[model samples]
Target: MIRDKIRELLKKNAEAETNFSLEKPERAEFGDYAANLALVLAKERKENPRKIAEDLIGKIKGNREADIFEKIEIAGPGFINFFLNKDAVLEEFKKLSKLKTLLKFKTPKSKIQIEFISVNPTGELHIGHGRGAFYGEALSQVLKLTDYKVEKEYFINDSKESSQIKELGKTVLDEGTSYLTENLKSQISKLKTKIKNLKLEKPKNLYGEAGYLIAEEIQKDNKKFIEKELGIKFNNWISEEKNLRQKNYFNKILEILKNKNLVYKKQGAFWLKTSQFGDDEDRVIVRTSGEPTYFLSDIAYHFQKIERGYKKIIEIWGADHQGHQKRLFAVKKALDWQVDMEILISQVVTIKKGEEIKKMSKRKGEVILLKDLLAEVGKDAARWFYLQKSLDTHMEFDIELAKKREEKNPVYYVQYGHARMASILRKAKSGKISPPATFTFAEDAEILLIKKILEVFDVLEDAIKDYQVHRILSYIYELVYVFSVFYRDIRVLDSKQERERLFLVKETKKILANLLRLIGVAAPERM
Candidate 1:
């Protein structure tokens, strides 16, 4: 909020020739915050930029709000840097402790829908999907914290197209187009024989398509199994085919586009003039066979979001789907809707088994399922591992590291700090010990750790405001690193300053709990 006030001042003082932007200084000595208004003005004014910066600093000094700035200094090349006193930092902490009281700042809220992990139901979730799920879920939480009305959703593909995909699987297995065909005879025979051998009820005569059906049944079993095993659940499971076919929304949108001359007939198919909106080429909305293209259904689905009255719609997609963005943007522009759509791209995942890296393939039965990873490492560690990195970076998942029982895992390191705090609190409660009314922030490491704790709100605000989950992860790691150094030299329950140290530990746990909750991770009191 103070930052907003400072921005207003800069805007008021800015001339037609000048613009100012706040930038984080590379080093604290340069100043806590810096701007380059002078550099932006010099070209138009044809005067020395440093002189302009000095004049601005003098003007800033006379303003009443100038108390917010402890010192304003002109740095190299006309960079004006401002430093705030310790009170400014503490004020942020006080405000954060009462963050709920700050919601009045955001008014006239709009509904937002965030759909993530819309992974097809053909197979179990893998590490690749996990990134999107964790990141998207965390982002939704951050959005809610910022006072945005948010709805979390998942779009499941369980329709005629899904049936078509099942048919493809069935066809690969020599099943019938609608029923199981002959190619899957052997698997069917094997299943029957195994069922009979186990003294179970006899399986049906349908071989190929029946076999594929059986396979799908087994995969659904895996889905449920994996969900419980991985502790992942969705708020909604939307069947795309059913939704698309039920209301004929796709045809309606196509007709509207056709009427508006946005759709053109070509080669017995329909195409959208997507190239007009920066797309490399026009996209086909319908195939020659009269079947709607995936793009058509996607456009219809996005329209559904707009119709649902969600002012903002966010979709988390894998990197391979980046090309799809242009077409989606084209449709948005074509409709002239005021909706905001954001697509987060997640990088590929590499799975490692000890020193060996293996290719992941679902058809070849070599892919590592999310269930398998959770089973090996467990839900807490599994979730934390994925949340530790930026979604844009290619993540290397080493099974060995994940399966470790020691404190080598970053999650454990953070959780240990929490559990240690819990242990201290439990003992203190048992002995009826009380913390000091006034705690001292004197030790170098203690001061550093406390200052970092005070910055938790800032980190969360930055991550939410900028959509940078990596920044939050970085903040967590920094806090842990600082606390680790402090823990090495300080003891909480046994030290002479036990009460104050215990209080610090309690504060750390509370902050860590909040961080873990925001990222959809559980902070266990005992691990």
Candidate 2:
């Protein structure tokens, strides 16, 4: 938001148009924000950078935009550093006294659908799915907090035509595959009675029927575990077989591709001309035996998102799906539709137990179930550890550090900071300690903490723009570190300025709680 203000000031003041950058300086003496507008202009005009910086400052002062910053100084050959007015920054940030009012960005509301953790119904969720699962849920919460209409969705690959589902069916029939586990055996046992009740043909439709039914049972258990244990609730559970294929939606899309001459017969199979639209090569839409490929179903699925009125569709996939972006873009090009599509591939995760990790296997075999991790480290720690890392990087989950109750643990450290603030307010029960009539922060610790707190707006803006949820964790760590320094340096109970300091603690708690909620962790009053 402050960047927008500087952008407007530069637009009205400068003679040339250049894409400038405004970044927060790592050191406070360099000022609150540093801009490279002068250097960018110097490159174009072939003039001295410091002279350009001085001219821009003069124009900014003339335009009366100097009120936005306390001082504008030129540093190191053209970097424009802006130190914000302390009182003005405090007025804006102190309004974050409630969790609901943090940032309050009035972005235009558009419908967004985020599909994540679409693990096939063939097996229980594993550690690999946990990354996208938690990332999607936390990102959805963050979008909703920023006033976007967001929905969480899961795509179930339950079609009997699917190779994975057919493999699951093979396990059910014990016909060469030994993937049967306790859960599959239980589902197969129930499938026998259901098949007997239907009185279907002996062997013709038996394999597909058995596989389809067992997958449905497994999906129900996965849904329960996700909602009950992992605290994730999807708004929609889209079925590949029932929702699309059963309704002939897949055939409809195939016909559209064929009618446009986008599909051709090659080697006895129908292939899409994705190479014309930027794929590495043409991809098969139908097998040689006339079965639809999974790529065809995915094309149909993305079309369905647009048909259902979602302007923006984001998919969180696993690392295994890398190099899959090209074909999806080709699909968009072939359809000739302008839509905002984002696909994030979350990397794998490793677990460290420090000699006490209890890793239980799922139905298919031992692959490290997500529920076991949640059971061992707990929901809050699991969420914090997963969300603290960037989605594109591999991560390790250390169970020993996650379960630590002291300040060495990151989640514990943030929560304990909030709890300590609450303790101060509890002891200073001066009947709703509100700020005095003329309140001004005069201490160095107070000024530093307030400046750090004001960056919450910039953090949220960046998260919304880039979909980088890890920024929230990084911001919280810095905010709390400065607050800890402020807490140690200032007196809050029975001091002459008890009311103003208590008010600061209360507002800081709101900001901390709101940020923790974005990561789906709790900010406790007492540890």
Candidate 2 backbone collisions, by pair: none
Per-residue lDDT tens digits of candidate 1, residues 1-527? 55566666665665453456776565768766688888888877898999988887777777887787678898889988887655565455445444433232252477878898877644557777777877787787778775578788877654443344555445434444432334234444556644344333333322323334445544465457645664546565565656775688878888888887998888999989989977889999889977777788888888877888888878889887987888888778877979878888888888888899875765565666676677788777777778777887888877788777667867777777667667668887426544455555557677567767765655665676668876776677678777778878776666777767776666667777777777767777886
| TM-score on alpha carbons, each prediction | 0.82, 0.94
Q: List the residue pairs that clash in candidate 1.
A: 175-181, 176-180, 176-181, 180-208, 180-209, 180-210, 181-209
Judged by whole-model lDDT over C-alpha atoms, candidate 2 comes out at 0.84
**Candidate 2 wrong stretches, greater than 4 Å:** 1-3, 15-17, 98-100, 195-200, 355-366
Native-vs-model 1 lDDT? 0.69
Assess each prediction's global lDDT (C-alpha) against the native. Answer: 0.69, 0.84
Model 1 residue 483 CA deviation in Å: 2.4
Please report, as a residue range, the 10-residue window in candidate 2 with the lowest summed lDDT: 355-364
